[model samples]
Target: MRSDLSRRRFLGGALALGATATLAACGYQEDTGGSGTSQAWSYTDDRGRKLGGDRPKRIVAQVTAAAALWEFGIRPVGIFGPSKLPNGEKDPLAGPIDLGKVQSLGNVWGEFNYDRYVSLEPDLLISVMYLRDELWYVPAEQAEAVEKAAPTLGVDLAGVSMPDGIEKFRTLAKALGADVNTPRINEAKATFERAGQNFADAAKTVNGKTALLVSATKEGMWAGNAQGFPSSKQMAEAGLTFLEPKAPGDGNYWEQLSWENAGKYRSDIILLDNRHGNLQSEQLKASYPTWRQLPAVRAGNVFAWNPETPFYYEAATEQLDRLGSSLRTV
Candidate 1:
């Protein structure tokens, strides 16, 4: 069986703490504080080169960047290597402006069709996830190379240490021409704030339940840590506590547990990380009859948390949306 537990950590970029709380205060600003009418939009990347001027019209987003771009009201003309849907659909954007309509720009993952992407004539292209090491693990250089083909702006949130969702959205929006100060932007921000507060309130009320956030692939299972990984954090915030090991080691790691050992943890809740294709629900039920008999599953507390949603994938924005939706039934 192919294991989904990749040895390499996925670069999810920098998450600013209390990010949602401070977003309304963040906005597009000129480095030198130029006049609003300067007609020159200037911003800098990590390398310090000035960027911005003409906003992107036809945008192409691959990976988590789509979530951030979506928040900015900048829908892409195309997407690369999209996550599958529960219904077994590819490029879920098919009905309106299907992936069929967009040109395929080969991905950094080798899944993308390079020739096709260049033919699309996009105004801007963005990449979110990190490529494997042979690909240099440098999302920025790859983006710059693509920009040589079309003005591209690449942002990989896996580690810059920026604020979480709210701050991520604000920074991304301004970069993409979306106004952080606008009423619409504020409205989106407020909606996220309310959702976050709701989770916090719920967490406080449900305080003693022991939970585990597990991502199962053919590879194995991964347990999330305390810092972020939204679902686990939000669940805790909503009153559900995780029975995380005192020494989880580092980051998200799979805790291999056989049928006999599965019940030892005695969790009050189990949040399954069901990605695009998850048939484990039934398989697990058959293999671990005791697990099915566990109080959480028996009480319908075992929930499948699909991280394929736009928000979860991007981690750039709408995290509260992801958090809200994940805890809906729990």
Candidate 2:
């Protein structure tokens, strides 16, 4: 419970709408002169805040945002989040960027180096937002300083459909001078579309088989709310049948269930949270007798999942393909 409580403390917070309002009222400088010499960029973020200024060359972004931008040829000068694995391996979410070239301000949640962030002189800051909570990756305590440093933009990952979210990132990248029509970029998009089809076909084959997405901590197990998580919603749309908890807990993201009652929902396949330190579903089964009794665990049908995975086409395609394969076999 200590770990879960600490995670909630680090990731949970009320939006500083007052700060957002103040920043919005200040108004951004629009390059109306139409100077042909220097290109100007403007974008309306998910929060409906208009952000306009000279094209940003030095950007600071959350790990997933940075990865999306990297695919579009816009590299951030600094990135923050869990960028490395327990074995010091680069996180898959950060796969598009050369970590050696970027400044790592902080690698864990709630850890930010003000001095290093300021030194980067970023023109823009980007992160993902969970619409229900209106909280972005940036912590509430650091919001003011971070906003002061540069115009902040949030990709509304949870508010819209997954495809729409990906398109928004593409639009932002295009505004930032990305060549969206490049052969490589187009190939990635096509690949993603094919992966989506594959996933749907796989799910269709499964028919009545059900999947459960859950995260296990020492205190208990939490089931993912299909309606709350964009990825889970996408899977459901693609034909995957996810069991919804009878009683969704706080925020509609998860249902807290004690380990003893972990078998409450019988699932043919289990998607285990694989972010950084969370135990793999197999490991959980090995540790908890009750968890071992689950049909999915007993049948060895568990797959890893990263709830905060990058929304870029390439990453999304890979993840979907993995799930599709898992479904086809399970």
Candidate 3:
């Protein structure tokens, strides 16, 4: 959670910029849908630069990036980042990726295991970029070391809408030889399309209700900026009117407020950041006097919100279904 806020390195200034499907690692297979031959593999990431190799068979990726590719059928040999829960259960964001088979280089912030990474004999490394040049979980100090070990591919998840983010991953998966057009993947995509409309329809039904997205703390609250986040940006554009926070400070994605000033933004509903580390909504409402005063909290209109990174269609569909169902209720 916020304890490692420094590692968040989220959208600053201009702001940067799925589904569950089984992505089983079948041991670096052939790319029927990609790689025109010669055994040489190359992928041009969001940065518009080429990261190529001998049609990379052994790949390692950030957890979320693995989630996206897994659905499309491109399995990584290893993964890093928040790959599992504190309780040792796999993070749901991991989707259906079986962590038992994939080597985990690190499971927390600032914990990239360089030696273990080299031990895997990785051919390519993949991760999503939150800021233009910042790879989500690759520690800055180890960037050079990691890059030297294997060609790293970074896909930008910021400064773009959710659909764009999802498509970018699909593109990457295709380059890696995943047949995204498969029946299962196509069904998931179709479900996502329907989910988008479902949310739009729900937004219309709850026409004027304003939803405020936030992360609460004893000190105060950090309000989310819709435009700076892909999922929220797509939702906002679809008619889920979110309270737009002014003056986004150094963290271009959030507006920090003290407990005394928490009332600056009022909403008919609140989307609480449900990521680990933050006090849950009910807990905050019961313990923090300032939190209890918020109109949405007192009205019991709080719902969970997560950034939803790496870009998968199935996960996006699930998130949309939950948000739409919640909005229609409140």
Candidate 4:
């Protein structure tokens, strides 16, 4: 059996904690200054696990979680996971996190440092759970020790529509004391709302069109199941057709295929995974003749897809708009 690594050959399947009453705040930002260190704070994660304390001020979240919180104006003190690239620049999945201000515990898979994590004296550790109750990026070997170090939280990012996933983060951001009611957040939310209808309308123009979303490795390809990912689920719900594999592989997230079988499913457009370390459409063309022969590739109907896009309204709006524009060209 193949090991279940989050990156490379293994697709990841994916958290919460503490003591106080569950906060009633939803997605909107309340007038709370977000500095409620004196007031008790509690939040129930997607796994139904609740953790709380004096509104966490020294939070440590996985890079993606940090990015989502940053969008809502709550900066985590420390972050782990794929926050930095080999180039040392911030990864797109990191959103606009100021690397200089935050400490990165690990930049690659299976690289979390226990000593570094505990040294931060974190009040809360939050990460996205791609699978039920499994916190992404927390090394399984060290999970027990890490969980004992601080209160933990997990935001479910899978098996839910994009809007629903984003709302989950939004509510967590609000509960954490983000200045969500400000004009900036309101404008962002308004723009994101408009993009939803725009995406649906654009889907109408590209009638009979289809898209295939895939992430590749030197060994093979993994075509994602639209229903398994948040963005794809939302796009499909908007009436855009995404090709699904007849048989899904690990985690029900994607179908594993050798390079020779990559053309099994053909589509009008191909949304290639654009996460750091993943091969781009151009690279795929250069590396494989099969990729070159695909109709989508020949027509250049390939687009970059950041599968782990942070749950920020503006970021989501941009993502939907870009995909919508691509759908029109098909």
TM-score of each: 0.66, 0.89, 0.88, 0.87
Off-target runs (Cα >4 Å) in candidate 3 are 1-7, 11-39
Deviation of model 1 at 203, angstroms = 1.1
lDDT of all predictions:
0.50, 0.76, 0.76, 0.78
lDDT measured at residue 314 in model 4 versus the true structure, 0 to 100: 74
Least accurate stretch of 10 residues (summed lDDT) in model 4? 21-30
| Residue 1 in candidate 1, Cα distance off native in Å | 17
Best by lDDT: 4
In terms of lDDT, model 3 sits at: 0.76
For residues 1-330, write the lDDT of model 2, one tens digit per residue: 113533442134556644655565433443345544433777777776767657778889888788878888888999987688769999876868899999998876678887899999887888877643343457678877777777778777753556666788788899988897899999989998899888899999888988888888888888887766656677889888999888875656778889889999999988888876577766786689998888999898888877766778877888899988987777
How close to the true structure is residue 201 of candidate 3, measured as C-alpha lDDT?
97
Cα RMSD to the true fold for all candidates: 8.1, 3.5, 6.9, 5.7
- Per-residue CA lDDT of candidate 1, range 197-235, in tens? 776665554457667765554433455553335334444
Candidate closer to the true structure by TM-score (higher is better), 1 or 3? 3
Worst 10 residues of 3 by lDDT: 17-26
Higher-ranked by TM-score: 1 or 2: 2
